[model samples]
Structure formats: C-alpha cells, structure tokens
Target: MNGKLLEGKVALVTGSGRGVGRGIALDLAAAGARVVVNDIGASTTGEGADLGPAQQVVEEIRAAGGHAVADTHSVADWDEAHAMVQTAIDAFGRIDIVINNAGILRDTIFHKMTREEFEAVINVNLNGPFYVSRAAAPHFKAQNGGNYVHITSSSGLIGNFGQANYAAAKLGVAALSKSIAMDMQRFNVRSNAVAPWAWTRMVNTIPAETEEQKKRVEGLMKLIPERIAPFVTALSSDAAAGVTGQIFGVRNNEIYLFSQSRPIRTAHTSDGWTPESVIERVFPMFENDFYPLHRSGDVFTWDPV
Candidate 1:
C-alpha cells in the first residue's frame, strides 16, 4: 500500500479469481494499478465456469480502496480474450499491463495421454495467452509502452511426469514471451515470463504416495502464492524496465534467473561425411555436453527457502 509503483497504470490479469493469479492481481492493485480481473472461474481441469471467483476478487480490491472490475471471460476464446482488453480500456481509458496467468492441468503420462487431454491443456494454457497477448499488442503499440508478465512453469523448463501437455504449453509460453519482447521492443513493450513454484489447487493433484513425497509436497505448501507476488509486481512495473526477454522463477524467498537455451558444444568436419562417420566422431565429441533425462524433481530437489 505504501509503494505506488504502478500509479495510474491500467492492468489486466487473467485467471485472477484464485491462486497465484489472484495474488498478482491484488499486488498490482495495491501498487495503484486499476485492474481488470479476468477469470472464467472454471475447475482445475478446465471444466465449468462461474462468475463468483472473479467477482469476489473485484470486491476485495474495491474494499481495499483499489480500482478493479470483474470479467468472467474465457482466455481461450479469441473474442473473449479481446473483450478482456476492451474491458480495461472502457473502465480505465487505457491499458498498461497485461498478465497472462490463466491455465489448467490435465495430468497424465505421455503414453497414456489422450488427444483431448493434450488439446484441452494447450488451448487454455498456451493458446489462451496467445489470444490475449495478440489482442493487446495493438493497444500496447498505440500507447507506445506496455508490460507483459506471463505465468510459465518449471514443469516445462525442466520436465515432469504426468504433465506432458501442461509442460509443453508452459514452455511455449516462455518462448512466446521472448518473441514478444523481441518484436515489441521498438514499441517500448516489455515481455517476460515467470515460472512460479507455489502450492495451489493444480499442484494438489499430484499424489503423495511415499513419506518423502509427502514431505516434499509439505515443503512446497509453505511456498504460498503471496511469496511470488512481489516479484511479479516488480516485473510489471517500471522498476524492471531494463529487463525483458528473460525467464524467471519464484519459490518462497528464492528468485531465480533461469538460463536460456544455447549451444553448449559444436563439432565441424572439413569434408562432408556419411551418417556413420558423423555418428562415430561428432557424437563422441559432445558426449559430455548432453543433458540427462531429468525430471522436474531431479532439478528442484531442495525445499523452498
């Protein structure tokens, strides 16, 4: 409440009815941004919709003397996603920040995953951001400046069991954010993605089959949504103006700058070679550079700080 970092800014945050999105919406409002809280209020698996969740967040923001409006629009729909941007423009006269945070999970091992399962997650998590960000691009360009904060996931950055669709969608988002940053840099529009590690309803779907698993989940539970809000708010504000096209991670007290993909090793031959020759020489040359098939847990083994 003390820091009016986003004073006079108009922000639109999708899936702001609950969890990490809700925390981000609240923090932006508290920083003096008039907010358009967009949430379809669907179940974790992307089924059914209600207005209760979005409306509740709007009420809470208003009670705190912040400006906010509820928008029960599905981010997956192109028309509805554009309408969300319009809602902010109609209410606040202009939009300055767009946070693509809407998402759902349809967890299953890759082999067992259905086409429907894959498409459902992709539509909401990946396509949803694409629609909303595309809709807002013109406005951002017109304004001469804007900010985009996308909610990506570590599941995609690393890998995770039973989340092939979710991971693919999230990784797509990070790539999309980077592309947006590059294309919109001339327009003064900054885009970045955050892979948040928070305990939310989607995370609860993971089964704790062993004592160690239970303990780990318990540790994750302590990394509440609130802990990630500050960094998100900072990224959305002018305070992070110099930063863009970067991937970040938030877990409890820890904030990570994730390394982007780049060539670790390369091999060259003086003459054109057959597949067999290349396999014998080039493959062995980069053996140490090859990454292990690590799952998300293998990378983030420690508890949140």
Candidate 2:
C-alpha cells in the first residue's frame, strides 16, 4: 500500500484520547489524512472531562509528520457536535471521513442499573454519534462523497450480563448507522460500524486469570490492537465506496461481518388465520440455518478459529 493512500482526505475521530480510538486516529493520520482528534476526556465510566487526551493525540500526530487538530468538544450536545465537525471543515476545507470511536462504559445489570447510568451511556455512546453524524450529514451531502465508521461492541451485538445500558446504546448506534447509510447513498456518503473486542481499559476490567475469563480474553486478543485499525481504514478508503449498512467485529488480526437475516415467512390459510396457526406456522422458521448469516459475504468474512 502507498504511504499516502489518504492524501488530501480529511478524517475525524471521536474519543481518540486513548485505546482503540487513539489507535484508529493515529493510523488515519499516518495514511495521510488530515485528522481531527476529538476527546471529552471523561473516564471509562463517563465521568468528568479533561483536555489532555485530545491534545496528546494531536502532538503524536504532529510528531509523526502528520496533520492533525485537537477538539475537546463532548459529543453530547448538538452544538458541540456541530462545532466538532466545523473544526474539521475550517481546518481541511472538506470533511471526508468520520470514525465515531468515542464511548463510555456504565456496566450494571438491568435490575441494578440506574437511570443516570443509562442516560449517560446513551448520551455518549449512542447520542454522541447521532450528534456528530447529524452535524456532518449536510456537509457530506454537499460534498457528494463521505465515509462514516461507528465503533460498537460484542456486548451490544450478543448481549452481556452487566452491560444492559451499554449494550442498548451500542445496538442503537448500529441501527442508526444503517438508517443513515440509506440517506447518504444519494450523496455518496457511506456509513458503517465496527464492533471491536480489544483489551482496552474497558475489557481489562474483566479478570484474565480465571479459566473462563482467560478464554474470553484470549479469544478477543486474536484480533490484536493493530488489526482493528485496518477495518476502519478500509471503510474510510475510497476502495470501500458503496459499502454501507454493514457491521464488522474486529479483533486478533481478523474481521468478521455480522448480519440479522431471519427466515421471514408469511403464512396463508384457507380464509381462517388464527393466532395459534400463526405460531405453528412460524415454529419451523426457528430451525437451524433458517436464517442466513448476516454480512457473510466474501469481502467481509473471517475464520473464528
């Protein structure tokens, strides 16, 4: 690959102060995109804010001879989100790529989860992407070209024990991206998502010594730190044009595409359709392989082993 594959393009990454977000932001910069590094500087649990993370990322990019600007805007309010995009517009004169990697974890079982906890995660993980994407929507439409990648999680994809709020927010983000992709098609704006399992501060919280925990962590580590960025980078590239409304699980040097296609069958009886009949007719759809695997196409498949 050419060193300047992204030359003249502009990429913006949110929650890029640390971990997967930070890695993605740097990679974009390295590939020759003028980058906008955004971070609210909140803790892993979404508490207070700090400006250091954003500034630090900017410095790293600069030191590596890449172009970058730092934005401390929280992706909470609409205005802040708008300003965040504006920062990129004012700097590079055009917005080409967006990686919505900013997120927070408020892990609690549904029964014990508080409204505040729920709202906080929703605001940042789900609404934050909404704010940024909405702000960029018009600009993307005007440019006639753009790319979007939202960071999601397996916890949300498959559900986790203590992450009801986080899971809900992540799933909401995936749904939101799919919807936006349809609107962006006319404008050449492609929106997709990445569900990453990395040993970041969030995953590090799970104990690694226990057999169960070790197995889980090891399975995730298969998609190492650097592997995740390639998925985002590919999505951000012109090569991935028209590739929208998709979700990828990235880790351990592998990328797995996920989908939700069920054997949707409608039943027809001789003018007598009861609820019982409806249930009985649909029972067979529950059989294995009735639902085709989602996004299991050649361009986006990986062997779990």
Candidate 3:
C-alpha cells in the first residue's frame, strides 16, 4: 500500500493543514507520492492565514522520507490556484493527482443567511475546486493522464438544516466532477467526487442546538478523518482506472455509492394535462415516492461502522 500505489506520483492536497485534508496529505505521502501540502491555515470559518500548518506538514513528510512542499495559496483565487498548481510542477516536475480538498463552513438557516455567508462558503467550497481544477486542466490535457478528486459533502447530496450555501456548493461539485469526467475522458483524464463523512473541524462547527443535533454530533465524533483517506488514495491511483463521474462516500469503514438525481417515478398522459389533472393524478401517484425532509443525520441513523 505504500510505494506500490503511487510511487513517483505528484499530488496536491489543498487545505492540508488540518483535519481531513491533513489525513489525506499524510496518506498520499505514505503511499509514495511527492505531495504539495497546500493550506491557507485559516480558521474553520475560512478566516486568516498562516504558513505554519502547511510548512509543518511538509516537514512531517520530509522527516518520514517522503517528498513534499508547502503551499499557502488560496484555492478560491484563480491566480493563486494557478500558483498552487505551479508549485506542484515546480517541485516535482509534473502533477499527476489533484485533491481539491480545501473548504470552509458557513452554516446558517436559509432564510436568515446573508449574501456574504452564502458567497463565502461558495467561494471556498465550490469555486475553490473549480479554480484549482481549472488551473490544472491544461497540464492534465497535455499529459493526457491525471486524476481529480473533489471533496463533496452529504449536506448537498442529501439535505441539511442550515447549510444551503455549503450544500449548494457541494452538490455543484458533484456536477462539476461528472462534467469533467465526461469532457476529459477522451484524454484519459479522470474526475470523481467523494463525500467524506468524517468528524473533522468542519463537523465540529455544526450547530448542535437541538437534542437530536447534539446526538448527531456525538455520532459524528466517532468518525475519524483518517478513515476517509484510504478510499481517496485508492481513487487517486491508476487502480481506479475506469472509475470516474461517480459520487462515492466514506464513513468509518463504510463505503457508499450514492444515487444521483433522476426520475424515480413518472406518470404519463396521452393528452396535455391541465393543472387540476396533474394535481389529482400525479400528486396521488407521487405521494408514496416523495422524499422526506431528512437531514444527513436522519439518513445515516446508524452509528459509524
């Protein structure tokens, strides 16, 4: 699992200063990758910056006899993202894998959410991946081979209470992953989205206002970030040759394949139906198939496996 998987591969893992990203960076390096540990070193809410975290991870990798460098560029900025990509190329000569793992949480009730809150989450979570991936697109095309792993979330894939921004951004990441997979498959470039359910700083920021929320948080605490890395490492390798355009999940030892949005149920009428007809026929027919307003916790009611 160490040198056999990713020997000589160069990887860039954003937000690698702590939590899930940190776990991933360490795993990639342990698997024989020359990694670019990129982190803005900001708070969980995506404020401030420090070079210490990234540098420390780099030091850790180096001390372990793996290769790595530190990058402090903001993945949300187009120019900075390009620079981050450049760091990989400069450090290891070429980048073979990109982990778009940088993100921030700004959870607020939809109605009460401000534009700033929504945009901030979108900037780091959604736009950051796009920026970083786009920056690496040319190199991937040039090499005619590459792997992209976008860190998506269940908040968007399923539903959540006060994370419209995070959810929207994460779901958009799923679409982006799919589109990239389709668009770049001809070039032998692979793109996939992963929704990692780990108890990281991100999960720690969730508001446990209600008793149910508190219990959910308690369940989450058992899911360590390290559990999420092995699957990601597998996906980042050539062993995942034909795996692209898919949404996967990792919670503790459990791996999941999520269902994308599709027409689960349909009703047909030979003639054009009136509003009344749709209500009477379609409403009754679709009632049983309707999805409940379930949060991420509601769906994953079982303890982490």
Candidate 4:
C-alpha cells in the first residue's frame, strides 16, 4: 500500500502514446495498475496514425517492471472505443480506471473557422470521451466500481482565442463528466474533469508570433505535463471515493479546484420583465459580475511554482 496506490487495479489511458497521455500512462503503471496504453498515434491535427508511440510506452512500462499492453484504436469511433476497453478486460480481467486524454486541435479564429475544422475537433475531443466512457459504463455497473478522469481544457472553462472548436468540445466534456457522475453514483462509478496546463504537444501548436503569444508559450513551458499525473492517479484510486463530479486544474505544482457555474447574481421584478426593462435593470445589476474576455493565460498571470 505504501508504493502501490492502485494495486490490483487495471487502468486504460487514451492517447497514452505521447505527451500528457504518455506521462499519465507511465504514472498509472508505476502506481501498480495494469494499464492499457491505447493510442492511435495521431498527430496534433488528428491526421495519420502510427503504432510506435503506444508500443514504446508499453515497452517502457515493462522495462520498469510494470504491466502494460499497447492498443492502437481511434477513440473517435464508437466501435473502436469499445474495442479499446475490451483490450483492457481481455488482458487484465477487468478495468478499474479510465483516463480520457486523447484530443486533437484545429485552431482558427471564429471568423475564419471552417466546418471541417470544427467537426474534426468536436469528433475527437468531445465525442471520443463519450464513446469510451459509454463503452465502459456497463462494465463499471457490473463490477460496482470504476473511475473516469477526462482531460478537459481551461480554454473552455475560461476562454481563449482561435479555439472555438476546442473550447466548445472541452466545455461539453465537463458537463458530460458531471452527468456521468450523477447517473453512475448508485453503481459506485465516479467521473470528473481536469483542465491541465502543460507544455504538451497540444500546447506546442500555439503560435508565438507576437510577444504576448510568446509570453504565454513561455509560461506554458513551465507547466510540466507529468505534474498532472499525481492528482489524476490519486483521483482514480479508491482513496478518492467521495470525490466525484468535480472540475480540477493542474499546472506545474499547482492544483486548483475550479468553481462551477452557479447563480451568482440574480434580479427580478414584481412584474414580468419586458426586453426593455431587462435591458434597463438586469443589465446594470449584472454588469459588474460579468466575466471579462480573459484568456486562461491572462487569468493565471503569475509564474508557475
């Protein structure tokens, strides 16, 4: 129990071939979980797949005297997602933890964003998690316990430029996580979302043409992807049994519990509000509380510790 937080547990980590996913897979394996290192080895834009990355991570785990298996399957497809989960069960008898970390980017400003760009990001980032989690739902129900940790983004939680597609999908994931937690509570299945700030391959895509963008990139570089693994692994363990339906963030050594959407300011009139009245009364009342167009970087201005 001292060294093995997940002893006897079997975990599946999507996109485990590279970057943040790779770090998470390694950590989960080190924690005594037999891992299914699933990755299509897709590039940042979700094009092309290679088997090398997944296999290499599996080999690394084995070299460390840990158990892991490689699986190359696209999480975007419903059938393929199920196959990935089945790989875990086939190899380890049962799967106890799932980390939905596979994602793609097609960043473009709203005015210039194309349908293909939008759909592509949505399919992988949003639909992929749903497919994988849905596939695992029955098994979790049968076993009476399982954990899900989805890799979300602050782009959605806060806001970002040139990432409408990504933000939408990530925000949707947060909602999905919460809904899953509520629905599966009786079955002892838990779900949560984590927005990780790290200099991963995904973050590498951010252009640093301007000084501001360069600064953001520099700050991102300070956020080590591996730093996200500890919190995620702990959350996946039975030790976090009472923790579910939460949104968290990990940046460098900083772990944050983010606030969810709740009614902060409310206003009502004795009579039904007309559009004109609402504009006159409600607008001013909520004006101070209205969130500004601050990007994730803007909000986290301080250097990572």
State the local distance difference test value for candidate 4: 0.94
Residues 116-223 of candidate 2 have per-residue lDDT tens digits of 999999999999999999999898998798999999877777766678888889989989999999877888889998988676777766556788667766654554
In Å, residue 256's CA in model 2 sits off its true spot by 1.5
CA shift of 222, model 1, Å: 1.8
Q: Is candidate 1 or candidate 4 better by TM-score?
A: 4
Cand. 2 TM to true fold? 0.88
Write out the backbone clash pairs for model 3: none
RMSD of each: 1.2, 4.0, 1.0, 0.8
Residues 55-160 of candidate 4: C-alpha lDDT, one tens digit per residue: 9999999999999999999999999999999999999999899999999999999999999999999999999999999999999999999999999999999999
User: How do the residues 38-157 of candidate 3 rate in per-residue lDDT, one tens digit apiece?
Assistant: 998999899999889999999998999999999999988999999999999998999999999999988889899999999999999989999999999999999999999999999999
TM-score of structure candidate 3:
0.98
TM of each candidate vs. truth? 0.97, 0.88, 0.98, 0.98
The CA lDDT at 217 in model 2 is: 64
Which wins on lDDT, candidate 1 or candidate 4? 4
| Alpha-carbon lDDT, every model | 0.92, 0.82, 0.93, 0.94
Tens digit per residue, CA lDDT, model 1, 98-127:
999999999988899999999999999999
Candidate 4 clashing pairs, residues 3+ apart or interchain: none
> Quick one: best lDDT, which candidate?
4
